[model samples]
Target: MEVDGNKFLNTGLLLVATILVAKLISAFIVPKSRKRLPPVVNGWPLIGGLPRFLKGPIFMLREEYPKLGSVFTVKLFHKNITFFIGPEVSAHFFKASESDLSQQEVYQFNVPTFGPGVVFDVDYSIRQEQFRFFTEALRVNKLKGYVNQMVVETEDYFSKWGSSGEVDLKYELEHLIILTASRCLLGREVRDKLFDDVSALFHDLDNGMLPISVLFPYLPIPAHKRRDKARQRLAEIFANIIASRKSANKSEDDMLQCFIDSKYKDGRPTTEAEVTGLLIAALFAGQHTSSITSTWTGAYLLCNKQYLSAVQEEQKNLMEKHGERVDHDILAEMDVLYRCIKEALRLHPPLIMLLRSSHSDFNVTTREGKEYDIPKGHIVATSPAFANRLPHIFKDPDRYDPDRFAVGREEDKVAGAFSYISFGGGRHGCLGEPFAYLQIKAIWTHLLRNFELELVSPFPEIDWNAMVVGVKGKVMVRYKRKELCVKQ
Candidate 1:
């Protein structure tokens, strides 16, 4: 067939032009269509990174951080847990609204422990109100009364210690913290009459949060069974206490009272169940964290003689100024001891990982300017244990240097808002932070002023196996009673 060469060439040129336009359009649209997920930790097919993560979460994160950068994901069986490792990329994780990053799904394991209609079991709005109850109960004014109880508990507990002896500081602090918590939070009734029973029940509840329980909370496990029984017994006990208080028309200066008196924004009174649940949640939140922090503080202080001496010097100066009285205001003045406790918490945050369930896709930009889009349905997490020790944010991150938080240094503030998130940060930041600090300070201050302490055992290792990571084994310390020289 005779063809016009000019016509055929023109047609071919037109086809090429159309193809090029399509290519150009694709170049712009394709990039926008594909979301860039954070680097994934390679694992076996199906099982994914569960084994390595189960082996050691912090260790796995440390190993992967250099290779994967700060933002990375580990697929655990069916779920994806994306970790935001440092403050540089953690602001969004801390600040995102509940709609974006929901805690309700990821922390359902806490439902059984905290009881129904509270915390992770409740919706975000209700949870916020419940949290407000905690906030009100732990306010500075409420903490003043709590601190007085803390002081009394500390003085009473330590007075039993011999003039000169060796003891497991860890055991002592754990026991003492529960006593203080019971007095200040669980009410004077539980503290005085039912201490041992309530304490054992709490132990059962805490032990129920195994790794498997996170995924299968209702599994037919012995620990879960014990936890359920303990929770029931606790409810009955508290219900009786609540009823007795109501019948007698009595009120007490304690967290139990605070929760009992707590009213919703609409003015509805809290139910017996709600009050009990709030109290359980409060004790659960503060008990382990405070004890673990207290133990770590003592361990670190004893290990670092210079810092220990600094705290001792601070205690001496305070005694001279305040004449042996240590209250909330006095504990607030304990900047040296506070720094030491804070440094320890930075190194060993009891709740290693803070988590949320991503309900919508979001993007995060790291300090290095690398950006990644996190897709929905992933468990978003930040490790305070890892983040608090980032070399870029904290100098000699491994070393127990309390002065890093001092006025002139303030390394924690060097990075940004979430740099020092041992107690977490932003909207979901720990409401119990001030209370935790004061409780630790009260214990340590009394010890510093009344006893000369020395580390007798080797430094304790991190008990990574613990649900609330803490010092492994006993923290043995030698102590001798010392007379305080208060100015007349």
Candidate 2:
């Protein structure tokens, strides 16, 4: 019996060794593929191009695009990514269906931050229904109400400027947007009573949304642990709020109620866990984009005097027509300011790159009639950073000229579809675009009408460390109340 047992053990060990050797040999064997593929950006073995990609993905993409054409493959660690650059490729990317491309797979790393059973963590149909709640919450009628709150918050928050000395626009806008979003979306209980603690927790949560987290979400690290804790604490906080609301049988007209009242196709009520995840996702979507865009817009306007004068003139005209009463309609007429914001977004978009994981074999045809076959299980990335810089799409592509979007020179549309993708394009385009414009327009109109600001610091470079690219350090502006200054 002992001899038989030893023979069986030795046989099993030999079989495992044979399989391991076969797998190791296969790891280095490159598959022969049909159809043309863009050249893979080369790097050292095993790690491949991960170090370069981590250093500055935009820089690496730009360098590769010029050399490898619009479609190219690059390896990052064990992952193979095919980048589709320029507008034509962008059209194909944005229009691809869920079967061919899976956003959930690409963004599953966000599950920890967004909590469970919501958005990218769920099945596709469920996610669609979940996103419907967001759409309903952002509809015109709801926005009509949200705009009032937005204006009120903007006026109340800006009332404390006190003819400001030098203020860091980045720091101030981050706080301002969080307060406004919390008051409007998360319910008054959270905004009024739990603001500080919630905001602090949100900070820790935001810190955990880095690129490294996207790669290894479950790695035992301090920030990842803090992120998990913050997510749980936020869930507890929202659960308490929901319990109290149900106990009182009270309903409030805000996103929290909308989420609570939302249902699946089968009529199942949304869970409290889902509600908390929705709020975190909503804030996550709008917070960084709004805050960063506001800072960039402020910095750009301050640095360009001609555009500043033009926007200020438009604001003065609005004031002459509407006085201190700022509303949605008045905000709409500030077209010059709108163009300036649009231009700033083109230059420094909040989310620099959008990624999708390919689920099946797909073909991409370039303008030259060349077809590249993308294989299954490869990650695909589309960068606004590169798309916006396509020379033929925008004349003097690198210059900051807002007029490029004006009148006969509507450059965003000049190069065909997906040319200007600051807000993204196609089925997955931004739903909060109107709200973003309204909030930003309200704040800037008020600032332009109330204060004169000067750029007190040199234009800061991009802080590549942030998940969203933000201006480095302080973009300081020296300010004095316009009402206090005598007319020239």
Candidate 3:
């Protein structure tokens, strides 16, 4: 009887010891402050909930946010990732300076693609200046010239496909934008001489930017090797172009010219290497974003027949007033088309989530007066993908309704703040927004006036595995030359 009692006592003691050890480990992780820390569910002894979080961060976050409230910490192996949600939380997060929350730490994968001494690889001041060059190139007056290039390139692309044909816009739009971007941004030398080679190199760069690269950038993988090789090759090509421009003592009003004339704070002309890096950065920013947004816009508009009819009606009015000639001012008058694009962007933003690595201990107080501390070196995150779908911010969030953005409705403004962050908010917001809208508007307008398009299949499943999530597999569309079809 004494032996049985001793055995039960030992088991009870072991259980108590395990609980104390866990509490000790938790205490060791962070200080016990008066203010509460974000809720972190009990996970594995050493690794925590990393494996579960990594499986589907988007799905996991969505599930946890409701249970844990607006602010919570997700323990990833040894790292603590603090996710801030709600309108108030988003405003503070987006407006926070780079000093407090660094983007470079989370986006280190950009080092190989953008090369050294540029973008995420360099200081914020340097990157800020570099982005300014891009903004200058895409300025209002400069963009006026690009409209013609967009129209011309788009027209040329559709011209090759007879009176009727099926096009996988996944491939078709990618090629079209490459041509348009090359013509308008990369300059005449790229458009006329090095188009195919540059396209192939960019493909290699694209292949390297896989979702796995985000977490494991330095893996000894085939794609990473190809990505490095492609980066070197593109640098060589851009370097030669810059040299040739200087040797010829000539100039053109394009993005390349902006890079050539771009002067540093030190009064020295920008180097070929820096110019190359800047060009790659601009391309990286616009490449998938524009392509994916365009893809989504087409997929959604086609699926929603009533909206498609509305777009066609607007296009008819546009052509009546302006005739066949297209320009920036004329494209701006496309209110219906504009709202459609806006809705598409809201529903399917290119970057689902944005990350920041907290540099100092940051305190977050919710609107409800709940306080939490975000420890230094922890990752801070916000998701435009999820935010755009918030019921309070967007009415009937899942429904494809552009009328919500109409003058009287203006649902986006109802939230009165960073509610609609499809283009992001604050300083690091997408600089290419105007350019992207202009390009998309130009392409769609041209297609509307020229071709009769029909969706061949239902909307594609979102391919979350892609670095920038896009419609999975082929997005096929059938189009007939409108004028020819009318005559027939």
Candidate 4:
């Protein structure tokens, strides 16, 4: 043994070298191999981030975004909401199949509002079919007819404005949007005869979506009680209309008729309940969003004189070419006006956040190349309001610049598909996008053509209090009828 000391020393040195190599390998590889959850926002005991979230979800997201980076989570009571903040980290969020990221669970709150057996109440397959119905209802041909109705509604509504007067623009747009939506989507009966009653009921329905309602939709509260009543009454009203249409052997070119005429892939015609529910869903989706966007567009244009002049000039050129004819094609030609409205939506998207319940685990790599695993059962969310304002995505993101979307810049397309999600993108993108654009354009084009508008009130601030964020106070506007008239 003593004679073999050199061999023994060499063996000891080799063993030490192996030990050091193993340590180094583990130090480098083990951390890389472990599961990485998104950064979690630490909050109060048990209740977690609920209070801050309930106070201001967007503000909370904004505050946490800088600290947590693009992917992060905030616990609200028993729920863990993981946010995918930007386009780079959100492709799967927008594109995932229902089996991977299901919307039904996250949107169960809409059940009480949209009623049973339609939309959130139905399974994924049925929901897809229903969405198809919406898509068909808002097709280009259908939207052409809707554009005519929108123009008529806008003219009729604004014709009452005195030659020069001060008015609340927000109020005016809200009133007009409902009338147009009613005429186009709810049928002429609701528009001509029952506008006030139906609009009031919709008000009740809108008020029912209090923040707490998301968690306790069926709670025994006054708002919920009124909401249930409104739902029932709406069903009855629509049922009568459907019956009358069927019995009279009459049809109309509107979303109501479209829904009545719709059929599932299996060839099952929609029921009265289904029609009513779908109509309600359609109105709910468009009415407030259109109004909010319309107000923002006007507000932005009035505030930004250069953009306002650009849009007005576009209208002037359109009138010179079309001679006061404002059909779908003419409206389509008003690209300047379209960009203005789109920019407004980019700044103040009505639906601030979109959500999905993660049904299975998924990995997302962010723009910066950071990867994070979003676990099953987590509530996955993305914010259009936040993402649209990312400095990297849009130059001077906070400033109102419609030209950013103009041909040469096309900032929205610069970051690729989901860069501008004012109407969302991918699987659950808004089917009513064409309708929305046409509707807003119809209204704004009329205003620019027929009236000179000025923002009379201090520019309204974002009413963060609203479920659909919109102008906080009255957007008082002073308007005068234009003396120059182009033949219609």
lDDT of each: 0.89, 0.85, 0.84, 0.91
lDDT of 2 at 428: 83
Q: TM-score of every model?
A: 0.92, 0.92, 0.92, 0.92
Minimum summed lDDT over a 10-residue window in model 3 is located at 479-488
Question: Which candidate should be chosen as best, given lDDT against the real structure?
Answer: 4
lDDT of 1 by residue, 103-213 (tens): 888788888988988888778888889899998998889999999999999888987887799999989999999999999999999999999999999999888889889
Candidate 3 lDDT tens digits, 1-488: 99999999999999999999989987997567665678985568778877766676678777887788778888777788888876867666788899998888899988888888888888899888887888888899989998888888888777788878898988888888888888888888999899999989988988998777878887879999999999999899988888888999989867889988988777878888888888887887887888888888898888989998999999878777777778889888989999999999998898888889889887888767888877888898888888888787788999999999999999888877788888888877888899999999988887777788888977788887777877799999998887732110
lDDT (Cα) of model 4: 0.91
TM-score of candidate 2 versus the correct structure, residues matched by position: 0.92
State how far residue 63 of model 4 sits from its true place (Å): 1.7
Q: What local lDDT does model 2 show for residue 209?
A: 77
- Please give the distance, in angstroms, between residue 260's alpha carbon in candidate 4 and its true position after superposition: 0.7
Instruction: Report the C-alpha lDDT of model 4 over 345-414, residue by residue, as the tens digit.
Output: 9999999999999989889898778889888899999999999999999999999999999998999887
Candidates ranked by lDDT: 4, 1, 2, 3
Q: Which stretches of candidate 2 lie over 4 Å from their true place?
A: 1-31, 484-488
Q: How many residue pairs collide in each prediction?
A: 0, 0, 0, 0
Candidate 2 residue lDDT tens string, 51-160: 88888889898788778888888897788988888887777689888887878888889999999999998998999999899999988778777777777787788778
